[model samples]
Target: MYYNCGVGGYISGIAKDKKTKLTTAMATIGGAGLDWHDVKSYLRPNGLLSYSTLNDGSNKLIFNNYPGGKVFDAVVLQDNSQGPIHPELKKFFEKYAAIHSKDIRATGAEPVFLMTWAYADRPEMTKQLADATIKVANDNKAMVIPVGLAFANALKDRPDLKMTVADNRHPTAAGSYLEGAVIYAALTHSSPEGANFLGGCEKPLAQKDAQFLQSIAWKTVKDFYGWK
Candidate 1:
């Protein structure tokens, strides 16, 4: 599996076999301060990766937004946030998740919940995020992709690597790799143990570290699914 993200890494293509190329379709519109409802607006098709907002002016918009009725194999939802587990935000999350989950299921597609990592500074949020995600996902009957667990497991061993960037919330390149790997393994049910695809962070992640994260992702996903 390869994790390639024009906007976000659906994944950087890491193939156990070097000769093959994996193609994926992903559209993202997010950053800090964006919620699941904000992202759900971009769920339309035609690869309109970005709608070309201000601040990032140099990026030329390539794909036009397609009309509605587009179908996806699975709809994975995530929000890059810090206080989402707060009492107020938790209610909002539940509301939006219900809306999006029902919409995805209505389209005959699987609804996947992306469990993102909380800041190491606010370690308490880790469990809160996981628990909240599981609760909401279960209520909606959506599969939970435990990327947060992969990050937690990876950091326990590879303390030298920075999962969050300088902001203490955003993910660094290695963090993104871990997220992608965990998502890939969860969705595919295959081990990333030997996959060499480093997504877009070859420099940030050395060969050994990349492989280490891959193993963690595989284990986390397998464990979450109760695989023997």
Candidate 2:
């Protein structure tokens, strides 16, 4: 039931808490750039709560749209300058988890899992970031949802599905949907009808898009759990 307390509020209204059966525990990544202040606003006055990636670093990375470095081989800054594996990033996610934990506990709901999706320029860098990111999540014993692999897979076939106008790295509306699909699948433990639901959710992406997304998503999930 945790959320990013930003655009994630939009996802609050999908279907009453029948499946999850609980009010959401919201969390914002970096606690910045949120369109709304709290779950109430993010979910809108009328929307019921489900889940969304309002504040995870992966989503923040997507929002920042930081390009991958040529030498680093990753999109996000993972060097010592950024304090790779330092307390700052850990603290950021820690504070995030603490807040959501408090919120969920107060609401008497059991914490489920956490979702993240980052866009890096290369596979090697993505693995590095994923390693560090996974460490942080595992240290806290929270389920970490991998959305990057999903994004990468979603684009395998649809080479035209660029997230940014020039970079093809940041997530576009379609990319966001791909992220949502991954998170949705994790929370529900059931796959959606389509891998990447585009066209205002009325029509699924072409078969190529679905396969591409599915390909990466499956791999990401596999890596997350060491399914291989």
* Candidate with the greatest TM-score versus the true structure: 1
lDDT of 2 at 117: 38
- Taking all chains together, each candidate's TM-score versus the true structure is 0.78, 0.52
Candidate 2 residue lDDT tens string, 101-136: 344344433333333333345544445545655665
Per-residue error (Å), model 1, residue 148: 1.0
lDDT of the candidates, in the order given: 0.68, 0.42
Q: What TM-score does model 1 achieve against the real structure?
A: 0.78
Model 1: per-residue lDDT, tens digit, 152-171? 88888888888887778777
Model 2 spans > 4 angstroms off: 1-90, 110-125, 155-160, 165-169, 193-204, 226-228
Residue pairs clashing in model 1 are 2-12, 2-13, 2-14, 3-11, 3-12, 3-13, 4-11, 4-12, 12-199, 14-197
TM-score of 2: 0.52
lDDT accuracy of residue 80 in candidate 1: 52
